[model samples]
Target: MGKLYVVGIGPGGLQHMTVRARQVIEESEVIVGYTKYIDFIAPLIENKEVFSTGMMKEEERCREALRLSKDKIVSIISTGDAGIYGMAGLVLELIENEQVEIVPGVTASSAAASILGAPIMHDSCNISLSDLMTPYELIKKRVEAAAQADFVITLYNPKSKGRPHYLKENIETIKKYRNGNTPVAVVKNALREGQEYEIFTLDSFDDSNVDMLSVVLIGNSQSFVKNGVFITPRGYKL
Candidate 1:
């Protein structure tokens, strides 16, 4: 029987890959992931075999990995922390007597939050606004609930060409539960060179300016702007 490792390589590039993840990927005979995500790590595993899927079809990818584990050592890769809407959720279903291991990495939200300042320093709940599978109403409810609960909100899947108005929907949902002046930080590909971050007051967000590649953080009532960075304190006072 072969062992399976589900690894989170963090967001973008080889530099972000953890020491543990690199160790496992090097040992695995087969590395599997969604294609673009696979490309991001291709250079790291040139000597090993790779299997990737184009887009969607995540369940199919997981099943294939399950099959591969029956025959060879396999690493199923995900970007960012595996537990956060990443490959870990899918692979958890396929675990057998064969050992399945989850290796953690820095998720983009934490990376982005660090770049912008300390917005999630206190209490926060991360929510993805993509309604691809979940109902728009449910997504809306979660957004509203997150905002109302006064939790620092880190929203993923804010915008995409096919579903272009999620950012607007997110802004609308926050408006329902928070004041228009609630501070927000919009980060584009955080940690990558030339990364962009903007501090916006909730009342003035321009929907067309946001995209799916970005991560949006809406601060709680206590969230503040410090030296131009948006921050939600984790309640640890000095």
Candidate 2:
């Protein structure tokens, strides 16, 4: 049996992908991922057999990758770190015979933090507003608890055309514990094409541009904005 490499491509860009990930993909005989994700690394996968599925077909994709791994070294690709809402976990769950390796890559949260300054310098938590796999009520509780605990909240899958109001709901819940002045930063398509970074206060945030591709970083009570940079101090004397 051949090895199965789960690789994170990091926002679908060559510059952000780790060298190990690139090497694995190049050495693999087959590559598999979501159709759009595959397109992101299309330039590097010359002459390799590729399999792609549409959105919401994660299980099928994993199964296909595993099947391919039976005969060839296969790399299952994902955008951003595969362990965080990527294909790593699913592939692990379905792996029964293949030797698996994980190639980690940059996550959007870190990429966004780099662009927006140090908003996650201290305690922080990431929450996904999408309720496809998680229940909305449970997600809401997490939002409220993260806020009450004063954790720097990084939101993934903030909004989509199918679930347009989830981001607003999370912001409103954070307001219950945090004052409207809390610092908020939104980074869209971080390190990828058409990237955007904007800072706002809790009360002044414009949800018009937020979508599934955006990562929202909302600061805790000690967070602040200075000269267009959003920062959450680590409490060390400066």
Candidate 3:
């Protein structure tokens, strides 16, 4: 049996992609992933065979990747960290004694956090507002709990064309526990083309500007902004 490698290519930039991830793609005969993700690494996989699927075809793509791994080394590509919300979990379920390697990459949260200065230097939790596989009510509960615990919250899949109000609802939920003036940041297409980032207060957040590609960071009570930087203090004596 040939080997299967699930690689995270990081957030749509060659510079941000981990070296090991690039190495695996170079070694593999076939690369499989969503169309946009595959295109992001097109420079590296020039001669390799690529099997790409459109959006919402994750399961199909994973199954095809597993099938291709039977005789030749195959790499399944994911944007950001594969283990976070990538193909690692789905591929793992189909692994049966196959030589498997999970190559991690920088996730969107870390990339966005860096761009936003240092808002996650303290305790934080990441949540996705996408209701594709998860129920909306369950997501709301999770947001409520995170807000109540006063954790720095990073929201992935904040908005989509069909679910524009999800982010608004999450903001409302978190506002219950935190002050309306708490700092919130929305980062779109982070570290990639058409990247945009903006900081606002919980009471002033604009939901219309967000989409599926955005990541929203909601700071805890201790977080603050200074000189155009959003920061969460790590409590060091300064």
Cα RMSD (angstroms) for every candidate in the order listed: 1.6, 0.9, 0.9
Candidate 3 lDDT by residue in tens digits, 80-199: 999998999999887776778999999999999989999999999999888988999999999999999999999999988888888888899899999988999999988999999999
Which 10 consecutive residues of model 2 have the lowest summed lDDT? 8-17
Rank order by lDDT, top first?
3, 2, 1
What ranges in model 2 sit over 4 Å off?
none
Give per-model TM-scores. Answer: 0.93, 0.97, 0.98
Q: Report the number of backbone clashes for model 2.
A: 0
Task: Give, for candidate 3, the lowest lDDT window spanning 10 residues.
Answer: 91-100
lDDT: the better of candidates 1 and 3: 3
Report lDDT (Cα) of residue 190, candidate 2.
94
| lDDT for residue 9 in candidate 1, whole number 0-100 | 86
Model 1 scores what on Cα lDDT? 0.83
Pairing residues by index, what is the TM-score of model 2? 0.97
Candidate 3 clashing pairs?
none
Evaluated at residue 187, the lDDT of candidate 3 is 94
Report every candidate's CA lDDT. 0.83, 0.92, 0.92
lDDT of candidate 3 vs native?
A: 0.92
